[model samples]
Target: MGTIDFDGLAAALAVHGLIPRGGIDFAKGETAPPGPSGASARAVLLVGHAGSSIWPHFQAWRATQPAGLADPLDAWSRQVIGAVAVRFGARAVSPSDQPWLPFQAWAMRAEGLRPSPLGLLMHPVWGLWHAFRGALLFDNALERPRNPDSLHHPCDACIGKPCLKACPVAAHAGGGFDYPACLGHVRSPSGSACASGGCLDRRACPVGTEYRYEPAQQAFHMAAFASPSIASAPTSGG
Candidate 1:
């Protein structure tokens, strides 16, 4: 097999506007366990935009499609992850399945860093606004070290904690978010606000406040949330 040029792959992804600001690392099973499980060598994360503009595009796409198709977003996600895997000789996985904890652990170990408010040690630039679109694991080793440390968490100094208080249902209070309650509210027949727009609480997060989803995007995602597939899928952090 030809040598994998990680720097080149990173540059290509950036050019395509998939990755915002994150780094690459060797998981080594410390963070992503199962001892590599015969997977690829590198992982790539596509953190979605946390602003209003993302909605219109989503709505337009969904409107043109037939019902019960795999979530369009999942298809888009696969294209991105596949591109990275093909370019870097790696394998990919979805965050909806693996979640962020293991990846965060691997990143911290690889980079020798900790979490920041705006940029967690594991994921920088996205703060909580970021969600992993997918990851790529490679079978070959590269020469890059862990990313450098960042010392800022925008939420560190945020007063009022708007994200905690913005929930109309009080779902995010007391350091624990009430999922069933929040989901219930969103899915409730009376909750037209979610269908019309999106979650008030998530938009209220002071950190990355600029990244709120546009109304159309909000509707699209809300539609997905209300879909039986997503509603029945296992839950994760908000």
Candidate 2:
């Protein structure tokens, strides 16, 4: 029940390549994220990064950890974000947690985002280059941050929708993702381009081209998407 020094918190997160994407107040009729002690969170602030902002930070942390760590990104996210939450007297939760938190819904509400052809929330500026890694849940309502962009959804104005065509297997065609097809392609010999450079469909998006993730970052995510069971493996110590 104290005013949040949100700016200070943002600065702290930035050191670890995280940004405060936005927030929602439960008092405003928004669904609350599960809070500590079985209570409902009064407010939730999303923590994430745009483009390859977190890549270097991630790589640096990865270097310090034991080899072959499972779900290194998730571990790093929980480690960094959880510490920030504790420092701010808040509870931190991740997208990978059990019972599945509503991160996508929370993201759309917080940033006024719409889904893209690739199923990731499309940002006018970051396009498909951003992600919500975790969230900070507070006991008191916090003011919602204003979205800087006012333009309607970017996909509405897209003429070619090249993202639909860039995939060789057309895994994203027909308004649905062919997860099995996508996984097959990424693991096969023909998947080298996607395996090394990232998803062709995602890279084809003209929006937020400047913020596109580097190949290493892209490859990392693609690996995770292709082999999800890796996440369940025991994580190496940080």
Candidate 3:
């Protein structure tokens, strides 16, 4: 029942490499699924990370675990974000929920971002190297203006469209993402390159070159990506 300090929350999250992507007033919006109907919702803030900002923290946390957890990153994020939400007086929701949250739509609205040809949200600076970790819902509104569209989209300007061509199986082909084909290829021996370094298609993006995740970080994500149980885990962008 006190004023929420958005800046303080953002700084605290950054210590764990989680950054506030954006937030929007949802007081008048439809209820998010799995959320108790008629609940007093107010605003929703999106969380994300860039590059290997989260790598060190994640690995350090992983060192304490017994091991063999199907998706350690997802495990770690949920635990941490859930606790943070309590302190901030908000509700924490993840994309991997049994009844998934519409994180994609929320992210697009929050950040004024659009999906790239690869079917992942694009950032003018982070390209495909960033991802939504989760969202925080508050019972009070916060002022945050939507970001403006860039004069030129990174994918639109690239005549070569390297991402589409880089995939061995054309998983992101024909203007739509082929999830099954992508999963199949990642599970094959031929997918070793991608499995080891990260998605070949994602790395091929020319924008945000400086923001690319280190090979080690990318490998960790790739490992999770290739896992069937972790496949549905919520992470957009990288």
lDDT of 3 by residue, 175-236 (tens): 88788888888889998898888888888989888988888888787777777665454446
Give the per-residue lDDT digits (tens) of candidate 1, residues 117-218: 212231234444444455555555444554555545456576776667766778767566576777788888767886777777666665554555556666
Scored against the true structure, residue 74 in model 2 reaches a CA lDDT of 88
Residue-wise lDDT of candidate 2 within 1-238, one digit each (tens)? 6788888899999998889987877775556666654577888888999888888998999999999888899899999999998888899998877767888877777778888877778888888888888899988878655554334689999999999999999999978989789889999999999988998998999999999989888888778877757443211111
Q: How accurate is candidate 3 locally (lDDT)?
A: 0.78
lDDT, each prediction: 0.54, 0.83, 0.78
Tell me the TM-score of model 2: 0.91
Instruction: Supply candidate 1's per-residue lDDT for 51.
Output: 39
Give stretches of model 3 more than 4 Å off: 27-29, 33-38, 144-146, 149-152, 230-235
Clash count (model 2, backbone only)? 0
Clashes of each: 22, 0, 0
Error of 3 at 37 (Å): 12
What are the models' TM-scores?
0.71, 0.91, 0.90
| Model 1, TM vs. native | 0.71
Instruction: Score candidate 3 by TM-score against the native.
Output: 0.90
